[model samples]
Target: MKSKIKAAFNPRTWWPKAKDGMHNMSPLVAFFLLNLFLVWIKTYINYLVNFNLGVTGPIQNFLLVLNPIPTAIMLLSIGLYFRGKLSYWLIWIFNLIQSLWLFANILYYREFTDFLSFGIMGSGSATGNNLGKSIAAIIHPTDYLVFLDLVIILVFLLLRKIKIDRKGIQKRYAILTILLGLILVFVDFGIANVDRDGLLDRSFDNNYIVKYLGLNEYALFNANQTYQQSNTRKKAGPKDLQKIQQFVKENHSPANVSYYGTEKGKNVFVIHLESFQQFLIDYKVDGQEVTPNLNAFYHDQHTKSFDNFYNQVGQGKTSDAEMMQENSLFGLNSGSAMVKYGASNTFESMPGILGQMGYTSAAFHGDVATFWNRNNTYKSFGYNYFFSKEFYPNANKPSYNVGYGLKDKIFLKDTAQYLQQLPQPFYAKLITVTNHYPYDLDKENISFPATKTGDNTVDGYVQTAHYLDQAFGELMDYLKKAGLYDNSMFVLYGDHFGISENHQPAIAQLLGKDKVTDYDLGEFQKVPFMIHSSDLDGGIDHTYGGEIDMMPTLLDLLGVPTNNMTIFGHDLLSAQNPQIVVFRKGGWVTPKYMKYNNHYYDTQTGEELYLSKDKELAKEAKANDAYADKVLSDSDKVITGDLLRFDKRTDFHKVNKKNYDYSKKATLKALKRSQETNPSSVLAKNDGHSTTDEYTTDAPEYSSSSK
Candidate 1:
């Protein structure tokens, strides 16, 4: 018995010999197994890199663990139908291509920390050079293991150890392989369904799809969705537009009488605070204010501040926030809406609406316009001018930039010239950097020293937030000096959370929380949203709002009726506005309760409550869920189906994408055209000059040249 047990355990003795009839593998079978092994290795590597699965139990873990098997099997099954060397080489080529695809994604995921999307692939030419230069940094020594099977198979074939079999598997074997793959896929879905109800129909996150399905499966699914949306858009009619319009009108919240049109006709200045969280506002580290200027602005008499404003962003992050704020539309559940559908979708955006009101709009950011596909998206949004990094001074200098673009100070200073050149009552968005992730700063730029949280990320966050505050202060001073301050309606909102869960423990310690709970994580996601107008009443409002609410609220204050547009959010300042804010993920917060993944919690205390036991609470939560789901679905229908193309009666004008261009030369062309078309424009009236030329800054990289 002992000898038998030892023999069974011994890999060398128990190894199936080639001379054995059933144990020997044909070329086709060997190829299939090799491909399967490589795919499993790819899956393991993916699991190691992407830590966002949020797998809770053994079932979920198993589902993610086993996801790649069926994808590989299904893909490799194609070779089964072919015969002879064609089958053998075809499978080998497939395996090689699959390995390359997996390897490429690993590198891409390392840098972007995101799954490669159709949008990224479609726009590869635009970003290829930049990505190519940094490929070395993204490659890990262990990544080469994906090619081990290919290397081994090639060596064996070359050495004549494994001869190519002329005979292919019969049709029965092909059917069996396909059946087996389908059965495995079904098993995967079963586990995923039990772990996450409504997995296929409602799992909007690409990460979730990739976690449960393999990358190939996700790619196929995403491609199908893209195609389906295109096909739907092609078939959509006026009835669909009317249906969406009716829904929007029925759900619309009337603006508050007092706040409505409060800042009408004012120049709109939107400051996008990159990676700024609400916790940074008024936060002190070692008795030193982390963001003094922003704290003061939050408390300013003219600023209407929302302490509970959540950033409802998905994978697109900053771009998603921008889309929501500009269009009163929720971003796509996966991939950036701007990148995915920006070129095609019609928007009744703030810039276009304000353009009808004699305002010329522009966006100022110190990064290349190509990033986030903003170049095309902004054009679709009706911006007359887009001053990307090409227009910024010293944009080519490495020291002037960190992370995504130029430091906030230099960006603000450099963009002043272009900002002043725009027509009066202009709608402009200034996106600030320096406070973004990997929050690093030059020693001289650091105003606040590292905190005592024993977390460098948290400490760096404090310093960068402080720097951003000072940069914003400079912008305010410029606006004031240029006489644009009092007449401009200002909006300051953080794009999203800076500190993710990995740094939440240290952040919780800094926030005086005893421990980081799910509630604490949710709270940490809050971002500051403030509206400032000189004549408006200002105070802290505890209303729950999100990026989706920005456009509606702003348009309401600007006296633009939104009845013609399909708006998903309400004027947050309106007493009638639904106070419920739904996050991109399946989480929502109302005045009384917070619902996260169907789990309910007390809004005030964050105490957990069971939904099954609480009858009234359960009903209320169910109603909210239904409403939220309907809103998202309707929004998706409009975007995915391109319902706006059918609208004829609505005040929202269809944009002619051809009218706008995003080239560096386009800015100059637009500036010249505006001078000719609108003689009273700020630039035309200022004698073809820019008032911002007078603006001065203490930034080390600051240049006075307007060119």
Candidate 2:
């Protein structure tokens, strides 16, 4: 037995035989293996150097290396069906395609912090405008390595050192290779699932998809997704639109008359609080309040805040929140409407609705236009102007733009320059990003210490929230001083949960609980939603609602009816609004019951109840599960089908995407032109002087010399 084992392992005995086998191997087999090896090496190299895949531990690292092999196998095997020179050229073409794909992702990841997707490719005009300088900026010498193997192979081909066989690979060998590749693909998928459960299903992150599955596999996945959505849209007709319209009509709740039109004609400013949760509203760290400005706003006499407000974002996350806020429509169950349907879908959005009333609408974000595909999405929402990263001064500077966007305080301060220039009664959305994930803050900007929870993710969350709070305070001061606060309506809301469920140990410590159960994680989805206007009555109302209610509630307050449009959310202030809180991942929470996956929990108490044990509880859970599923399915139909394009209603005009441009030069030039013609901007109201100068802050980055 020992001798047999030694014989099996010994390289001295097998080396000569193995070398002879290689020497006698067929040219077709050699060519296939060589291409496969080359593609695998370059993909792994690109993964390591160009992308931040968050690959952890040895298993995931092995899977990352293994993931690219099957794609090369499956792709290269196609040439096996042809003969001689034709087969060789076909194989070379596929290899070249893969080479180009890897290089494209490297450049895209540098600019967007994301991999290339069909969604992005379908809307190339957004990033392809300045193909010369824009792409050149992201290119580095190391990126050229993706084509190293191809170049070497080309050189070898030119020298005729390696010759292609005159005959094609046999059918049996080709079939076997494909079968082996398929088996390997499934094996890689199974290992990834074991490592991170629901990573393929529940994770909407492109980075996660590429990290778990190879770049080639992710492209295939996205291509399949794009084809399905495109086919669905193409097959859709007026009947599908009618079905969605009926659903919307039935789901709609009438606005509460007592609070309707309360802030009519007021300047509407939406502050998108990124990754902020509801628990932080009154949370205290040592002796200091985490969010003093938001806390005061929650209790201010002129504010209306909801303690039970929730965020109904899906895989889209922040973009989903924005989608629900703008159009009163739920985001797709799998991806963001902004990225997937933004270019094609027609919206009866907040901007378009207000635009009809002579309100010039704009959206403000401190990131590039391509992030979230907002450049085209905002136009579909009928926003006349979009002040993206290009509009900000020195936006490319590291200090100005950090962690996915410009620093919060600097963003608000600089936005004032453009904000004052906008027409009065304008609807503006300012998206804050300093409080985003990985929650890092500048050393000088840190006002609070990390929690002793020992979890780095949870600890950093507080300090970033503190910094975001400080930024919000600075903006509020500026608004008040500029005399905009008195007449303008301020809507501040937390977009989603800051800390992920993966850090349960740290979350348990932070919450002072013995254990953090699945129920607690679901309950953690609550986010702060507050509406503040100087003339309005303020109170902490215990109304249960989600991000979907934002648009309808605000429109209701402005006395705008939503009967003609498709809106999934109801006004929180309405007595008739349903108390059901729907989650994107097939979960629903009501005042009495909470349902997630196959588990049912008592809403007030964190007690899990089995459906087999209680008949009444089971009935309620079943009904909610069925209804929530229906609502989600119906919404998916509307979103994936682009059914709104079939609506020929005269009340809401179809958005002409050509009328707007988000580029800095064109937007500023158009703003100037508009101010001259309309003369309704705050700057115009102030006799051509800037009101943006009144803003001040204690933030370390604040400068008195700033606009």
Candidate 3:
């Protein structure tokens, strides 16, 4: 019995033993470590291939490299509970899931430029069917390396080179493995916290969460967050709505009568300039205008432009901008509004509100409706029509797209026919995508030489912005030829900043600044907001506001009172209230002072304020900072509580989703009904001929074909 007990704890003669002071690991534990080593290798390869991981510096790479230690220990501890086939298969399945999960995310991130969230994965069969070839095209040959461990293990088992250990690991050893895993986890947390304070709490950006804690931890965090939001919505009280409405009412800014009803009863055309910035309005590269057409539109006699308009975006970026502009509510402080609560939230949106004003609203985009989960969001917005990629011809071809979807020229031109089919005084929005990230262009489409900046992305931005500008020129010509230009309320706005702080050095050359200052970063956030109407007076307004201000401004300009609505933004044209633009991160911009990341700066001088020297400015900054934080918290309470559902506004008409459908049959039926009722309809007057063929451009894809 003594010999047998000795043999149970001893390593086999043929087994490799550790040096002094190191414990001899069991074979099962060794196997788990080996498998996890391969997983680490797979993860490193994935990070290398995935450009959007945006991994920089040695510390980040080191954190990712350290992931396998805790992971292997945890799995081994769990597997030790059973022996033989049960244990073997359990570990195998764990490895399989880990590998496959990474592979799937590699494909998903390539298309969406984001990590796959549990919310999107639960989006059901419609989303799966819509994936199409886009997901498949992004898979790399080396991506198959992730499954190599499975193949090797299968081969060994089939060749009888290895056998499953039937004996369970000793309890002490199993407990040791679990304790080791816990220790490693604590170590990881310490290291991560050293790098970024409250790493888990500041998970508003998924990448930040992944950077400090690791992908596995991020998945768990996301699941918890999603559950919390779901629970919050279920338990919400009517008091939530009362508080929100009261807050908005106290903060409301009455409109300027000068701009009120300026373009009332006119058709509304909202064109979203994707990834565009205000600096490109009249900027030149090598003496060539980068965006001449947009500059011309900005200076046009009837255009109302904002020189100080900022983009208020959170983790959702462009989608967040849409949420703010349409709903007049801030997006969730974390995750995307479109993905997190789009299907469930009760939105008093632009389209739905306009529908009550006898306006038929439609949305146009050249990507799948599920790209940002826009399809369901649009329906909830009470849109009469949604023209996604399915509505455009040849949108699936590679030649028609660069990054996200169809090129601007083709998207706008193809959309012309559908636009004319809408009833008079309709509301339509065109979302452009040519100037998106990793901006690449075909040589034939490139009109200007690349900027001399060393950064390729900066140089590419100049070229792509020019291309989109040229497309805008074609769209203008088409609208004029169709007699829809002068009569419409044309609103063109840049959705967000094209370049981030990482690209600031390259842009510094353009700004003629030796070093990028806080002022420069603040200025970079400015986006163009142009409202053009033929009969209205127009000029640049120096109002400090954000995307949230747009909805109230539009409603006010259309002669609608927003006294009963729940809106977070004040009208830019209203001087009754001080215009304060609150950023998502608790910073704020006001005309007198700018508070950013606990620092106060003078708005006019662009200099940091010394608290001792500028006591008055510091006091104002503290107040503004507190207000900004309150705004973010209040916005979260409203969205998470789904408070709008309890709104008691007598003028508000809740969107009836059952009444809307995006199917071709539904769109055709609506158009047919419009023609039957209104003889003055554009499509009926034109005898159903396509008005898009009139659009002429120098673009290589369409120039010769159309002319």
Best by TM-score: 1
Give the Cα RMSD of candidate 2: 8.5
Query: Per-residue CA lDDT of candidate 1, range 1-707, in tens?
Result: 99966755453442234545454556677677877787787666667664344555687677777887886887787887888767766677777877877787776665444567675576554455444644654466888887888888778766867656666666656766777889998888887777768866775556677777767777888788767766877788889878878888998898888988878888999999999989888888788898888999999998999998998886567878998999877877656778777878887788887887788889998988887778888878888778888887688899988877899988988788777667787899999978876688888788677777887556788888888988898888877877789898999999988876655568678788778766677777799999999998999999988889999899989988876677899889988888989877667888888876445788899998877788878898879877777777777777778776777755657667788876778668777776677675565776876777556566655444432
**Residues 526-645 of candidate 2: C-alpha lDDT, one tens digit per residue:** 999999998888888988888988988999899888787777788898998888888875568888888754368898898987878999988987787666766776777788888888
RMSD to the true structure for each prediction, in A, is 5.9, 8.5, 5.9
Regions of candidate 3 where Cα sits further than 4 Å from its true position:
1-116, 120-169, 176-216, 333-335, 394-398, 500-522, 585-588, 592-626, 683-694, 703-707
- lDDT ranking of the models: 2, 1, 3
Clash count, candidate 3: 0
Instruction: Give the alpha carbon lDDT tens digit for every residue of 1-707 in model 3.
Output: 99866755554521334557355665666666677777677776676666334354687677777755676567645776777667766777777877887887777655444566676666533345434444654566887888988899868866866656666566666666677778888888898788657666533456666665666666777788777877898899899888878888888898889888877899999999999999999999888899999999999888889998898876567778898888888876556777777778898999999899888899999888787778888888788899999888868788987777898988888888788888878999999988976677889888987887787657888899999999999999989999899889998888887776545578688688887766677777889998889997888888888888999899889888887888888888887857788877446788877765445678777897766688797688668756776677678777888888888777878998888888877787877788778645577778877676677867677647663
Model 3 TM: 0.78
Query: Who is ahead in TM-score, 1 or 2?
Result: 1
**Each model's lDDT:** 0.78, 0.80, 0.77
TM-scores across all candidates?
0.85, 0.74, 0.78
**Which pairs, if any, clash in model 2?**
303-538
lDDT-better candidate, 2 vs 3: 2
